[model samples]
Target: LVRTGFEHLYEVYEKIDPKGARLLEESEPYVLTYLDFPKEHAHWIRTNNLCERLNKEIKKRTRVVGVFPLKQAMLRLVGAVCINQNEEWFVATHFMDKRSLLFEELPQREACTQETIDHLLQVIDSDFKVCREVA
Candidate 1:
């Protein structure tokens, strides 16, 4: 459904922004790449809060330092923060269900839910009838 909904977007990107379009095209496969993972892992990995939290921490720490003597110093600080964050995650209880991972991967695609269909129809204010359908 994501691919179907984004077809027009991909086309528009291709025409007006070739570079972005190229990147999108290259990354198209990874759009559903989450499907390759176990169903249990998807929910946790789907939201980027972990990344956001890490970035926020990095920004907060960097602000405290105020200034760096060199570019490598900033990088080293960032790396240290990342390593610290990784250790924290390792010590914390895992959010994924290991039992669910024992199972195989899930279906790659699914039909849109009724709620989604209705919401989109309401937003578009149309049944999305093409000119041919009107004719």
Candidate 2:
């Protein structure tokens, strides 16, 4: 049904405005990504409402704070907001029917290189030690 509607729109655009149709054709691959996901999940995947809402909330909170004393303080404030939002979502109405989710496992991430692992370990080890001598 969605694909049929998309095709009809393309046909109309091609007839009325060939340039507009060409632009749409260039974006066809990206626009059709929603169809690749489960129908139940398509609406959320196709929209930016969730991210826009979260960004608005963050901006409102930060506006009240004006300026943070440290980078860590800013991070803590945003992290707290995210935690609250996460808790709210658990109790809120379903975004999509829970039963419709496929619950498929995601592909495993690539392993970190030895150099990256060693650098991370160094940082972790340094964090446990004092930055300056006590005198």
Candidate 3:
């Protein structure tokens, strides 16, 4: 059986299918990029079900009308459905709770200045160089 995690599983696949394994290794950065997101947001980020469900709702509503006399009428119905869907789950209990999502405001910072911009660029350049060396 494949062992329980990414590295172990990758090692096994690498032995069995070197070409496929190389592709995965190349994609490893993107495949695992979700890990860089806040854990709480991972579920929503990793799946398109929410969007699919929203589209399904829109289609269901539009299908009922069969046809609209004006494009605006259809748009209005879709807009309302979007608003309702947004409100239905955009709640503290369901999700979209800023605190739970780690959306707290940052501590106030000094006003931006040209000097700070240059310093930030230098830090970024140095970090990028370090990463290039490691790679």
Candidate 4:
């Protein structure tokens, strides 16, 4: 399934952005996995936060000067940020740590509760409507 998704993305990326497709091809497989992640799971790893954090780091480094003497300075700053984020994530504790607490503390709910399900469905429907309107 994952391989098929990557194949699909490789095809789409080649069509829409040949340069990006080439870059993707040159990247490690793990680095390119986000592009092929399922749409439902995409929201979990929203790229906006990643972009914003990178931009923040770049802006911080660039604020010392109005402009860089050459593009190398900017590239070096952003490259350092990418490397730092990669290392930081490797050392970070993740969701599994909270699993025991969640399993023990979660409120028990009846599976046959139609009212709860209907209310949740209504909430989702309203959110969809609002999203469509905003879009």
Candidate 5:
């Protein structure tokens, strides 16, 4: 239904701004990614608050530092911030209510036979050889 509405809106938007419509059309695939996930999860996935908050935090921290003397120093600061944020999320309440429709689990893997194992080993050996040659 949302897709249909967007398609209709696109038609209207195209008449007003062909170039803008073309850009939107190009980005449509990415914009509608939430549709692929469970409807209950769409709200969380579609919202930009999480990303915006993280970016704001990083900007706020960087502003205090003024200038980083070394690339490694900047990296270490950003890495530490990320690690701290990760720990907070780990201890916090669930982002999405567990009782809501759960995401579909991935299918179980097939048991690997000897032939399959041999083929995988052969592929790994070929990749290793290519990497060695490149180095």
Candidate 6:
């Protein structure tokens, strides 16, 4: 629904800003330039460009490496990359600002009791028409 890049900012700002053109011009410089996120919600942000670039880099590396010695080495390499990506994602301002809306301050609300799990399994089975969905 939303276009990527500064367009998303400009669109939202159009509706939110009271000053109209002047505010848009002044704010455009800030929004279009770099992400200026607050410290509190300084997590959860990403750009597809960065993801594509990283994937390209990983592919290039894979081509160079050719093969892994074992599955563990592959897992370790992928896990390290995931950690680095998570670090980067937390720092991006747009993501940090927006992502907080999607989550709660408290831990996830999960009912993990045996009865709850059984009920969950039954519901899932009924919905999907697949029994023994898990091993």
lDDT of 3 by residue, 32-135 (tens): 76555556675677887889999999999999999899999998999999999988877637564466546464343335666766565565556656766797
Model 1, TM vs. native: 0.67
For model 2, the local distance difference test gives: 0.70
Give the clashing residue pairs of candidate 3, or none: none
Task: Candidate 5: give its CA RMSD in angstroms.
Answer: 19.7
RMSD of 6: 21.5
How displaced is residue 118 in candidate 1, in Å?
9.4
* Candidate of highest TM-score: 1
Kindly provide the TM-score of model 4 when superposed on the true structure, using C-alpha atoms.
0.38
Clashing pairs in 4: none
* Model 1 backbone overlap count: 0
lDDT of each candidate versus the true structure: 0.74, 0.70, 0.70, 0.62, 0.72, 0.54
Off by over 4 Å in 4: 1-54, 92-113, 131-135
Which residue ranges in model 6 land beyond 4 Å of their true spot?
1-51, 94-96, 99-135
Evaluation by lDDT, superior candidate among 3 and 5? 5
Question: How much does candidate 2 score in TM-score?
Answer: 0.49
TM-score of each: 0.67, 0.49, 0.47, 0.38, 0.56, 0.33
For model 2, the stretches where C-alpha displacement exceeds 4 angstroms are: 1-33, 103-135
Per-residue lDDT value at 53 in model 6 = 62
Q: Which ten residues in a row have the lowest lDDT in candidate 3?
A: 1-10
Per-residue lDDT tens digits for candidate 1, residues 64-108, read 999999999999999999999999987777766656766665655
Where is the poorest 10-residue window by lDDT in model 6? 1-10
Local accuracy of candidate 4 as per-residue lDDT tens digits, 1-135: 334444555655576579988877677487666644443445546566766877787787779766888899878877887898777766767512434434434444334466655565565556656766797
The true-versus-predicted C-alpha distance at residue 3 of model 3, in Å, is 23
Model 2, 116: alpha-carbon shift in Å? 49
Instruction: Compose the digit string of candidate 6's lDDT tens values, residues 98-125.
Output: 6545644534333356675556555544
